[model samples]
Target: MTDDPTPGTRCRACGGAAGTVVLDLGEQPPWDRMPARDAPLPDPAAPLRMWLCAGCGLAQLQTDAAVAEELHGVEPLAMTEQSDRSVGRLARAGLVRPGGRVAEFGSPHGGSWLPRLTGRGMVALDADAVSAAGRADLVVDFYGLLHEPDQADALARRVALLAPGGTLALQLLSLGTVLRDDQWFDLRHGHYGYWSLPALDAALRRHGLGVHRAWWYPLSGGTVLVTARAGAEPDAGTRRLVDEERALAVTEPSGFARLQAAADDTHLLLDWLVAERAAGRTVAAYGAASRAVPLVCRAGLDASLLAAVGDASPAKQGHRMPGSDVPVVSPDELAGLHPDRVLLFLPELLDEVRAALPQVEASGGRWVVLGPGPRAVEPVSALSGC
Candidate 1:
């Protein structure tokens, strides 16, 4: 609320002035806001950065640039597919009990594991039905923790909602993967904290929950579904996850400068787009995701280098991406255009999108994966002959 964000001295989780700046991405608009097609470019960009809390070993946004308005997006087919596979893994692992009470904390963007729970014979409860605390056998929050402004309070509530021996299932972006993979863009306004199992173990223990078990997945760069229960200790599997994190030295503040280095690579995407343009190849992009905003804006992209972007969500189609003039179109329209190259913003969704837009390849267009490098990862055609 001041001219600049407070020099973040205190840890968001532990309330200790025991942290240091790790990454700093200069002034950026609220990435979540998609402006009206004719609206002015995003204004009043503020400093975007991440900090490492030595006290709790948590990585967090130093301060919020602005209060964000939720941008509704259709849950990608890949996310949906991951949800099914994750829940099925939980059931097979015996973490899910038959006919138990299930409570969910869905992301603001909207998606829930309740339907999957109900299919597993568990009873799903609405938010109001959950206030009689500690009643749930399973309290699930996938991709929900980072959105919370108050990390301490959020953890407390998720803990309080659990019954004795209840499993609080959390799917978090594994900090080890973030640092090791150079996914620096994950640092953004509105994302409060990044969790390593070590830091999270400290935070959860404060709330009477202990890390119990974990499962890793290659979604969203990398993700982990960690189970925490009251009075539990780090089980054998949990210890292994923690040990892997230690090997990466993720909790150290200086090691985090790697992200600052990645941020300096903003020109990478623009270079690829320019090459495509020189070849007279018309280019479009897919996914108007929040993470794509910083990358697109930082690279100084416009409708010229990157043409229209296709999104599955109707709410976003008529709007332009914030800070740029690129129009958002529907998926059907995206494939129909048969662009020479369609840059996919979210690499983790590569498979699902390939199947969804088979026409792009059938007509001689190749789908290019956008990331550290814009490379054609799939065969010339993914689904055509199959």
Candidate 2:
């Protein structure tokens, strides 16, 4: 990765001067660069700093350099169940109709919600192809805008692709929820910007779009779903959410203080992990999600502290973590390997992992989850492990 011309200098949304530095994650490798077992790893690391825009109150990553040409190189784990649920929710909210033309942006192969548009006409396109895809009744940009360098321009393109009064659905990580919980795992190199309800509403309103409906899903830690239409006005619910976010001090300096404090405490947790390993206690990790690359690096965890990182996705198995030599193994091997304790990278997928590795607990193994706070470690009971 090349150095950003103006590192930690400007906001991507409003182009304002860099605001308060809420959380500095130090230097981290690009999260998506998973190298093959025999391939040499990339040495470049960029500063992962989150800045709050004073002008628009938008929280964004300060790295202006593009890490990779494409965000995702392979297909992500399919969330068919969640897709089905979202389809139902949209239908109930009257955003999906029988014959409506729908376009899904940033959808990976085999993981798209396009199948849900059974009777509707649907097309799936990457961020760059939206201009050529023409118009649609519903444009769904799932987890796309967060990685955009110029959010205003990207959103303007989305608006151009939407038919008059058509719905534009954006599924993104909720900065309000992430900040409130102090979840640093959501802060990674791949995301260029984070959006709160107010910031998103503000951006949409600039394009003559208004929030029509919104929902929050607890999946992937926490995600916000907002559906907007061209001429619609911001509803009372939208205003209420904006007020609540403001009350949480989403853009204030104190909010950054809380995050900085949590980050400070994370180092203590890393110290504890190192101590545990020195005591001859075996420690491994579950899930090799891309976000884990930065978390593991920031925590100073290496192959020495962790035995191996296990992931269920075949795409990631047999690969080495980008900046480290830690091996990514199949989750099935966890029970057989039988580490004394396994640190879960994705807390949201804990139950699924427990079900898959029932014998890990039965054999006196433990699971550790880092969370809502830096030092917040919730150890799963040996009895409830399965």
lDDT per model vs. reference: 0.82, 0.72
Error of 1 at 193 (Å): 1.2
RMSD of 2: 4.0
RMSD of 1: 2.9
TM-scores for the candidates: 0.92, 0.87
lDDT string for model 2 (246-329, tens) is 888777656656776666666765786788788998878887876677777777776787878887677778877767878888
- lDDT for model 1, please: 0.82
lDDT of 2 at 315: 74
lDDT of 2 at 243: 78
Runs in model 2 lying further than 4 Å from the true structure: 1-8, 38-42, 69-78, 107-110, 119-134, 234-237, 372-386
Deviation from native of the Cα of residue 7 in model 1, angstroms? 3.2
RMSD of each: 2.9, 4.0
Error of 1 at 150 (Å): 0.4
lDDT of 1 at 189: 78
